[model samples]
Target: MAAENQHQVPPPPGLIASLAGLAKNCLHLLLSRLELAAIELTEVRDTLLQLSIVFAIAMLAAWFAIAFGTATLIYLCWEAMGWKILALLAGLFAVLAVALVLWGRSLVRQGKLGLSSTMAELKSDRDMLL
Candidate 1:
């Protein structure tokens, strides 16, 4: 029975066959990872597009609302404050602009948008493979 079993067993693959199988497996793995990345990229693109559209609409609405409100406020106080309200609003806008610029600069300096996660994954793969 043992002799019969031994005879029935398959032979080991040759070196070339082993290498070809490894290459085929590596190709499959690469293709799968690429597909996953493509899917994620598509999702991110869709979300970003929607967010941009909504933000633009909201910003437009807010701009008109603020403009009307400010105009009304100035009209109401026209006799009392004269041009002081306009000057005050201008100063407020200047301060807000400075604050926003500084905040944006800080975000850039922190490298928050830099592809940190992908870079880390690439580094780990490199370390593992090499």
Candidate 2:
């Protein structure tokens, strides 16, 4: 039986071809996934850029408005309350700034800027590999 099996044939060629095909398929899959990730990253970057521009413009406008409004308010109240209202408004602005900073820091800590979907897919791939 052993001699007959040896004389029949070796399967290296077919086995190698199968392995090569599988490897090619895997490479194609990986490249496709990478392309998808690149597209997603580009979209995220574009959205962030657009939002940053809008936010910057809005912030500039708001700053000018706030400056003028505050000046008017202080001038109008100067004869009655003097600097007391100005000090109170300044303190209130400082507190608001502090709160905004803390909230932004917390969002960063929570990974709000991360590529979450890509990270999740990569993690799943890693788990499958392991």
Candidate 3:
């Protein structure tokens, strides 16, 4: 018991204090990154909502234009090319639609909708920690 009492000197203060400070700084960094992610999420939501509205409007206008233009073209080509014009135009529109769908899919696959800045910052933080 006396030997135990003699060995009761305190641990090094600097290491403990530094660990506490490091814990505090890590917590602060996590909180700031979370806040930034939240802000970016809100912005992304707003942007997606706006894009949905605009895409809806554009689709509506495009449908009307496609209908009128197709009818006019069919009328103009009916006398000369007859039914072949209709089949050709259909095939052409089908190819165009397929191309557009492929492009949109590629964009999706490329992660165009991801939170770039947040991901970059997280990667940098991870790199620094490692």
TM-score of 3: 0.78
Question: How much is 7 displaced in model 3, in angstroms?
Answer: 28
Q: In candidate 1, which residue pairs clash?
A: none
Query: What's the TM-score of each model vs. the native?
Result: 0.72, 0.76, 0.78
Q: Across residues 46-98, which tens digit of lDDT does each residue of candidate 2 receive?
A: 98899899989999998998899899999889999998988988998999899
lDDT of each: 0.79, 0.86, 0.93
Give the CA lDDT, 0 to 100, for residue 33 in model 2: 73
Best by TM-score: 3
Model 2 misplacement above 4 A: 1-15, 106-112
Of models 1 and 3, which has the larger lDDT?
Answer: 3
- Lowest-scoring 10 consecutive residues by lDDT in candidate 3? 107-116
- Model 2 sits at a Cα RMSD from the real structure of 4.9
Cα RMSDs of all predictions?
A: 3.6, 4.9, 6.5
Off by over 4 Å in 1: 1-8, 98-124
What 10-residue stretch in candidate 2 is worst by lDDT?
A: 6-15
